[model samples]
Structures are given as structure tokens and as C-alpha cells.
Target: MAVRHLGEFVVIVCLTLVTSGSSYAEQLPNVVFILADDYGFNDVGYHGRLHGSAILTPNLDRLAGEGVKLENYYVQPICSPTRSQLMSGRYQIHTGLQHGVIRPPQPNCLPLDEVTLPQKLKENGYATNMVGKWHIGFYLDACLPTERGFDSYFGYLIGAEDYYTHMRSYNVGSKTLSGYDLHANKTTVYQYKGQYSTHLFTNKTIDVIERHDKTKPLFIYLAYQAVHFPLEVPDSYMDPYMNITDKNRRTYAGMVSCMDEGVGNVTRALKEAGLYDNTIIIFSTDNGGPIQSGANNWPLRGSKGSLWEGGIHGVGFVHSPLLPTSVKGTVNHELIHVSDWLPTIVAGIAGGALNGTKPLDGYNVWSSISGTASSPRKEILHNIDSLYIAPEILPSYFDGEDFLWRFLARVLEDKFDTSIRAALRVGDWKIKTGPDASASDVWQPPAESGLHTIYPIEKPNQKVWLFNITADPLERTDLSGKYPDVVDEFLQRLEEYYKGSVPVRYPDPDLEADPALHGGSWGPWE
Candidate 1:
């Protein structure tokens, strides 16, 4: 046996020949990764059984029942971070996307040198296709999906856009710039103007499946634009949720249902194309739902942009006829991060090599998901963002008659600077540093309940928070005061991670990216 090093990856070469009856002789399975935008923790029907949610997600529920549901999965707090990590198999700190998302006009994108998941699949004799939102970056043609290892791409270049009009508006300097965002590969597609993105992307996915060559495996990354902002959906889809008084939640539910229907349609297409038997379907959300936009995380605390479980604890599941019967229809509580998908699919499933790639922070968890072994990952570096700014201080639980006194007392004897926004998870313990006074740090319930309650806000002086997530998943109790030693250890770990982080790539919005200047379409300007 000999060991060979390829970039940061290690490959072992066995000198002995393998038997013809080995499992490695089998064909590779097709992969379909569906990513939902701004999906809440409690919005799915499977979670509704415990939270009594009014959202209708029959298709998603059925898919979960036939697969291993990921109850303890984690994503980044925003769109680009999660997507970048999913594509690169690296953390945000490694990719320089540690803070915020790629704004429409920013002269930035995922570093071009990074080896993406699609590229790896393509190397393994797979047809790679991408449909829907490409929010990572588009300032350069090198940043487009087609240029990033995908054979074909159909999607918007930025984040949220009008569902029917297919238009996105953002301020470039003093002017609010608006343009058509729908595209097919590198060309701006205008024919899809009136078509809803959820259905449009779904149809494209089916087309890809129907036209795929059977001899070669297929890899589809369907990043749906559903359940995101804009709050627009056809009225027919919302009729069932008319009971919900809140207009936004009602529309949001309809959006979810429409996406669910699309999922069922895609599955049906796969079956019709004879690809279902060997296809592995994985579903996950980009981040937690934004509470201000009529989405609810409910029992989980915090909203989209915060460092709480509600912001990063995502909905994920894996379904395939290839999975063992013992693992199907089971809930997995093991810790899994979004970055694990790249290696899991490339090396674990496709039997591909990871040569020429950078050091991957992800581990292939196929054995764990397949019920053969426990997860190899025990710790996850959530993030270390130096650019994070705490929201405006408001008079909540942090302010009272004795607030000034307590603030001065804790400030004088602080163990770690709480202003450094970072979080880390080691085994059952999770630690977060930085001020947690963001408006997104509140539990949002379903709109149909018509019940509103105020929760205690984190004290202003309290910069560090420690929670045993396995014991207290809701994160209601803060053990920082009780276990100061644990907090110190986690802080030191965070510091080590911070030292390895590259400079953030958030650049100022460029006027050249204005749609009016680019024939009314958003595309590469550099």
C-alpha cells in the first residue's frame, strides 16, 4: 500500500487487486440537491406535528417520511455564505465570505480558484446542471454558474426578485436600479417574464432529467426562489390558507405549497424518466426564515441574521431508493453542516478523486446517513465575522433601573470581548461571542395563532453565551456564568479560527453593474 498526496487531499493506493463481486463495481447514483430560500424551522408539516403549524407541505412531508430527516443540521445565517460553503466544501472564513451576502452590484463573487461541487461531479462522469438563484457572485463571467463547472445554468443572478416580472431592484449609489434577472446560461432570458420562478425552475429541472443521458450520472443543484422576500404568489395557491389572517404568512404558506408541488412534480419526472431507482434526493434551506417577512421559527430563538439556532439550524433530509430500509423514515440527531455535501457526494457517492482541490473542511458522512456508522464530525466553526455590527440598542431586558450598575460591573471584569461576532460548536456545547441585541433575536410564532408574547432579551453586558444544544435545543438557558472555563476554552478555539480567516470580500457596489447599462439584464460587468 502507498499513500499519495494531492494538494491538501490524501489518497491511498492499494497494491492488491479487488474481487469482481465488490460493491465498488456498482454504478454511481444520480444526485439532486434542492435548496429552499428563507425557509423557517417550524414551517414544514413534519415539524408542524409538534408546533401545530398551518402551513401545507404534503409533498415535503412525504419525502421526509421516506428518507432520513436531519433534525440537527446547520447552515449559515445568510444566503451566499451557505451556498459558498456548499459549493466549496469550506467554511465562510476560508472563502472570504464571512459577512453578509453578495449584493447585486458588488464587484465580488466566490473566489474563482475554488473547486466547486459541480466541477468535482463533472470530473466523475456526471452531467452538471444548475437551476434558480445564483447569489454567490456575478461581477465576472467567471462567477456565473456555467463557468463554475455546470454544463448548463438557468436562474437569476442575484437574490430576491419579482416572481412574475422577474425583476430585481437595488440602489447603486443614489439611484434605485431595476432590471430583468432571469437568464438561461449566460444569456438574459426575457420569455420567462410572467412565469413564476418556482414553476419555471421546476420545469427546467424536469427537462434536464428527461433529456439526460442514462449512461452518465446526473447532478442537479435546484436552488428554488420560493418562500423568500417579495411576498408574491398566485392568488389560487393562497386560497387554502385564507384562514390565516396575517397577509404575509398566508402568502408565504402558498409559496411553500407551490414549491412543494414543484418538488413532487420533479420526483414524478425522475420516475417517468426511469432515474428514480438510482437517484439520491437531498433537500435543505439556505438559512432560517426572516421573521419580519411573515415567516416563523417559533420554538427556536432568533431570525435570519442572528447567531441563534433559529438563524442557522436548517431543514434538511435525504431520500433515495438506494438508502437502506433501516435508515429510511428516521430522524437523525447527529450534527451535520451544509459544507459536508460536497465531499459526501463527490468522494463518498461517486468514488471520485479530490486531487487539485484545497483543504476541505467537510467530511463525507455517507456512513452516518446510511446508518452504518456515527458521524465523523464533532465540531463546526459557525463563523468568525469581524464586520458584524450589533443592531441599535433598544430598551428591553438589557435596560432597567439597575442596568447602568450591572453594565459597569461586567465591563470592568470581562473575560472576552463580546463584540467579536463568532460562534463554535464542540460536542454538545456551543459558544457564541459578540453582542446579541439584534432585532432578529426574537422567537416568531405562526400568524394563525393570533398570540403574541415577548421574550427576555440578552443583557447588554453579556457578550458571551454558552449552551448545551443537545440538552437545551431551544437555547433558553445561558450557562456562561456557571461554566466560565468552558466559555474560555470555546473562545480560545474561536480565536484560533479567527487567526486563519482571510480578509472579507465585501466590496462597494459598482455603478457599472447597473442593469440599464447592461441592456436591462444583470450579468458580468468586469
Candidate 2:
């Protein structure tokens, strides 16, 4: 089989296909995909981080106890890239989102041609719906989730929004676009003014489940905005974490608590709807935590946006009442990726095959996840530092004072062959560089609570480190010089993967260059 790139807290469900036989083909389990934004490795209780730690996630812990925890799940370091991979069942590189993110006013979006998970589920007779953040695209009406695949789409379009006011702001060119972004299937739901976003999304998910037509199985993607940024939570939620001391950490903990409550509410709704046991639920974080946002990836190196395990490895689990009773509460050490969910879900529900225009990077990992067979994944392309930027499409500021921006522009526009950062894991051995061999700080978490900040430093002549992750989960030791052959083999594999990646795509520069055309607003919709 081909190689693929491939951790998390617990939430609870077990989905067993009544019989291993095909007699009940029409009785597909309802699929509930719950995604947390900017969550971390040690943040969930099952990871042995919340016992006495500042982090608290009881719902996730209970879920972990009743479900299967994926100890080695992988995602991209950033939000949009991971979301793109999750939806399309391919790497971000294959979906034109190899670098940075899809910021506001940029017309760039997931290519419409790519068939998303919801789209495939819909094709198989499921009532597909989505709630919360949809950061892939929004400039064009066609790029919206409803038009893409989902029958309904609710929540904010940008990467982050004020949880209370549902407002978002983005700066591009000279325009700073700000507006109330809560929407219901492309139309803004103005009546929900001042409501906390976490609660709102949860209530909507429950409502969808309650109102769903039972004749057809449902596919609900509850993508919560909680715990991301603009860190805000209700007093009730924040009150429990008063002992956290640090204001940001306190609020962050509250946000997680509130979201955990929401998860409880949703699962309760499933039971109320008489669909709990026959439903398949998967809970996962979009990406690693960003320290700037009060997130902690304790004991793991690096924060969000870095190429370290802490940045991409997240808390995740698979729960379904139908899952084999014996494997319940088991920890699956199998390597898995966010993209694998699409095919896995499709196969789980109707056993349909992938018919996307491009070949998929995800595999049907149900066998491994269910403990019925070994994992098909052996390696993964962590990240490749390359983007096909179109210079003519960039604003005149391409030559401006921002050196990092300028360097990125050069890489994209000039088609420069520069390997700024790359990592690949073949078997238990992995190799990576800090922005193309220039050393970057390996962030280590403090032993106790304290304010900390990391500043990136360059070491142009720094040596690359290799680790046997199985022997060193913390990635503390460097075995490069000790195992030269392993490093060489992985490097060759990384290069091969980079050579096959698709070019990056961006929005029309003209659309973002004009302040009046930048997409955003602030008034309530009638």
C-alpha cells in the first residue's frame, strides 16, 4: 500500500454495523463530526494532563472512557489547511492551500471542483449540515458551504469572530473589513444577537438532530468556535476555573468547559432523538494550540504554525455505541490523519467509493480504528515548504518593508525552489528542518504555571535532528548522526512528496485591492 501522513482527548459513542453481513445496508449510522478549534495535545483529560493540571475536560474524559482514543492522529499546523484536508480527503498541498492561510478579503477558497465529505455523504442520501466556522472561502457565493455541499450552513465565515457579538474583522490592502458574521444557510441570523457562539452552535446542532427526518440518516459537522481566539466565555463557565490564576488561562479553561458542556448537550440530544447508539461521532481539534491564544501544548515542543508534533498532533477520538463492545475504551495507537475521515465515513455508512477528480491521500482507516485490523498508514508527508505564488496577482506591497511577507511572496511569485521547512516520517523515524536548515527554537513547556513567550531565532548552520518517535514520544533526543541511513531515506521520501504537490492558488488581486470591495459588514440583517 502507498504511504500517508497521519492524538487526542476523549468524548464518548460506539457504532457497530449490526452484522458484518450486508443485510442491513440501508441502516447506516448517523455521522456526527465535532471539531474543536486551536485545542492542544495535553489539554484533554485522557492524555493524563488534566488530573491536577489547569486544563479540565470531563466530557472528553468520559467520552474517552466509553470510546476509542486515537493516540497518533495528525493534522496541518494551521486552521484553513487542516480544514481543507479534512473536507477534501487530501493534503492541503493538493488543495492549493500549502502555505499560510486563507485570510479575509482573499478570494482564495477550496476549489469548487473538489468534492467535499458532506457532498459525498449527500450523494448517499444523508441530510448534510454544518455549524460554526467555515474558513475555506466566502468572497464568492459559490464558495460558501451550502453551495459546496451542505444543505445548510450556520455560523461565521472568517477564521475567528467575537463569540458574543458574532462580529469579525479582517485587514487587507487598506481596508479593515469588520461585520456581524453569524449566518444560517448564507443568510445572517440577526435574531441571535448577544448570544454566546458556543452555546448557539450547540443549540443549533441539537435542533437539527431533533428536527431531522428520521427516514434518512443525518451527517452533522459541528465545528465549534470555542477555544480559538478573542478568548471570551460566560461568567458561569469562567467561574469554575477561578483557581487557574492567569487571566488568559482562566478564560481559556472556561471556554473549554463551555464547549465540553455543549458536547454533552449534543450527545444528550442524540439520545433524546433515539439515535445515540446507532450514531457515529468523532471529536477532534482542528490544529495545535497557539500560545498567543492562551493555549498550552505542554510537554510537546513548538506551538501552532510550527512543524513540531505539538503543532499538528491533536486530541481526537471515535465514539459510537455500535463500536465493538470489546474495543470500547481502548486506545488505538494507529497513525491516522484528518483527511482519512471522509473515506472512513463513506465506507462506514454506505460503503461507497471515492469518486473525486484527483486521487485521495486518505485511506479507509476503520479497520485499524475499530481494532479489527492493523493501520494501513506507515508514513506521512508532514509539510513541504513550497507555494506557487502568482506575483502579478499580489498587491504592490509585495516589495514592501515586511521581509517575511516579501520572502513568502518571492517563493510564490518567482516559483523559487526554496525549502523553508519540511518534515516526513517513514516508519518510526522522522526528519525535519527549521525553516530550511536555519535553526528554530524548540519550545519546552514550564514545569509549573507561569507566563511564557517564544521568539523565533535563526541558526543558518544548525544541524537537523532525527528521532525514533516510538522510543522518544517527546522528541527529546536527536539520533541523526547515529542513524545516517534512516535520515537519508526519509529525506528522499520528503523530496518525492514535494515534487508531486499541486500549485497554490489565490483570490483575484483586484477584488482585494479595492477597499470598497473587501468583504465584511457590521449592521444586523433584517
TM-score of each: 0.91, 0.86
**Model 1 Cα lDDT, one tens digit per residue, 233-258:** 89999999999888989999899999
What Cα-based lDDT does every candidate model obtain?
A: 0.85, 0.74
In model 1, residue pairs whose N, Cα or C atoms come closer than 3 Å (at least 3 residues apart or on different chains), thus clashing, are 418-434
User: How accurate locally is residue 286 in candidate 1, as Cα lDDT from 0 to 100?
Assistant: 92
In model 2, the runs with Cα more than 4 Å from the true position are 1-26, 48-52, 387-418, 436-460, 507-526
Off by over 4 Å in 1: 1-26, 389-416
Q: Every model's Cα RMSD, please?
A: 5.4, 6.6
TM-score of 1: 0.91
